[model samples]
Target: MFGSLPLGILQLWHRKFRLLTATLGIAFAVILVFMQMELKEALYASAVRYHEALGYDLIMLSPKTPHIVAARGFPRNRLYQAQGIKGVSSVSPIYLGQAIWRHPSEPLNRRSIFVLGFDPDDRGFEKLLSPTVLQRLRLPYQVSYDRLARPEFGPIGQMIDEGMTVRNQVNDSEFTVAGLHAIGSGFAIEGSIFTSDLNFQRMFPERSASVIEFGLIHLDPGAAVEGVRREILDALPKDIRVLTRKEFAQLEIDHWSKATPTGVVFGFGVVMGLFVGAIIVYQILYSDVQDHLQEYATLLAMGYPHRYLKVIVLQEALVLAILGFLPGLVLSVELFRLTAESAHLPLEMSLNNALTVFALTLGMCVFSGLLTLRRLRSVDPAEVF
Candidate 1:
């Protein structure tokens, strides 16, 4: 068995040019799969950053709300009703909207950024922010900027860190950049601003305190989340929908993965990569089988079984998968880093993703070998002679 393994390897190495071409083809396929998965992950992760950063036990949304990016909110009066629930210990509101932000240096330049407004005094709100930064938010007209946001938001974050007084306009209303946060960006909204409810109201006078996009309900210690969810559902109006934190996060993920065109494109890219890989591998294995037809026929004439020939081709497949996957993996990591830095997306290469790609590569090569075996079975010793 061990002796036959080297025979497969020798057969592949016999034609150096063909082997090189095959390896490159396989590597390209692996890279395609990696990028597709990476983009898919980034899309989901970026879209759900707000959901993940917040530490809420239950979330309240309007029946009209479609997603976090462009959601129409429920009435703020619902928070008062939610506080009456048995397990509900606290209720807070978050106002979400978009505004054109003027560049700090380039005053004439502007771009739209997602706006998040929450009550600074509301201890029930969960966020990935420093307490000190939250304290600074108590100051009127001051907001925290996402440091990792795209450059189109201008240099407000950088300027603040440099001890410069940086202020930008949100729909012509001015706000100070008091601190920087790192919640990152999403596909729908590339830049985000965090501010207190008071400052938020000041910037958007059209948005009344009566209407809010999100209501966060915090349960008492050891309180049953499902019980609280049920209690809230029974108490809240039918116009409002209640969801657990996990369910809320999934809502955003589903929005991007199924409801958006970007997700479909990435999914299609992965399938095309697999198809291309299969074809390239099939061609390589077919050519190798053709080159060794005489040898395989001699083995058949000597009473060697068809299964042994199949095993040889499979061994070659295994070799190709391993050799191609390593270089592909190395290149993919570098690409992920470059993308994360340049695009400022939360792109990462996790261990599970690596293993998944490896399994796919093996499967692709092995399946290609199976297709080439039909040619192997047709070889006859007399015909070869």
Candidate 2:
């Protein structure tokens, strides 16, 4: 069957000005959808960067621990019990807390910072922090500061690089920036500081040695993570929770995605983008169909089937999708880079994200075309004079 694609393409281009306007509308919609989704993804990516940097197979936490930022301490004996599991190799306790960082440079300025205390001997986080940096952390009051922490922390990273240990207040107690790491910032906190568990206790003397915030479980080679997780979950008391490192990271993501208002806002933005795009595309398609109604009526009188007209409209919609998507995709990539650099976020453009947005664009245009069909179907052959 000879289809109406050629005619559809010709008709769309015939009105060059309208065609350009429609194309721009579609592109705008694409950019909106792209940025909304990319920002949501970036939030999760940056939130989990800390977890991803750790070299551990399983993560153990207190059941009260909703997420890393609010982690509560659990009994150290639970970690010992985990080490006895069949596939278990070793378990390292990690202490987590928050402290007000009194800016060393500005006495009046202060901000909250995350604190991570781990046994220097375990070296569980050695993948992210070099041995030398971890060794430096062993010295009391000595701590490694995140290089990517927000500037409010008073140039802690720079001070460390210059071979100077700048003194600052951590929860009203004095602490030093002995080294620098690049763990990046999260939504709840501006930056993070790493130190030995002993030093951490020295800074926060209220924290007990018998309680730890997290337990990093390293399994023997070829160990089944799911099985170990189940084993640990069943063996541990109700106060403890055991999960694979991946599951732990997802726990943090899920907390941000569903448990917080930020997730709702981002999701709402995405939906609004789609709605805005659909409306714009529908208007363009409806206008085109209206302009060509007399011609469509004439064609129907000439015995062309209604399905042929539908094909033409759909082809036009698809063309708009492709043309709009190309520029939108390019713009989104550049925007993602700018966001990552300027905002110090981990925003990225992945193939999956691209494919997802492309599918949404196609659906948006096709749905718009469907709405335009109402006008096409109403064209009566007999109405044409």
Q: Give Cα-based local distance difference scores for all models.
A: 0.87, 0.85
Which lDDT tens digits does candidate 1 get at residues 159-255?
8778998877888678888788888776788888989999889889888888999998889999999988888888767989989878888998887
Best by lDDT: 1
- Kindly report which residue stretches of model 1 are placed more than 4 angstroms away from their true locations once superposed: 124-127
Measure candidate 2: CA RMSD.
2.4
- lDDT of predicted model 2: 0.85
Which 10 consecutive residues of model 1 have the lowest summed lDDT?
121-130
Task: Provide the global lDDT of candidate 1 against the true structure.
Answer: 0.87
TM-score of each: 0.96, 0.91
Q: Considering every candidate listed, which one attains the maximal TM-score?
A: 1
Error of 2 at 376 (Å): 1.3
After superposition, the stretches of candidate 2 with alpha carbons farther than 4 Å from their true spots are 1-3, 84-87, 162-165, 220-236
- Residue 67 of model 2, lDDT score: 80
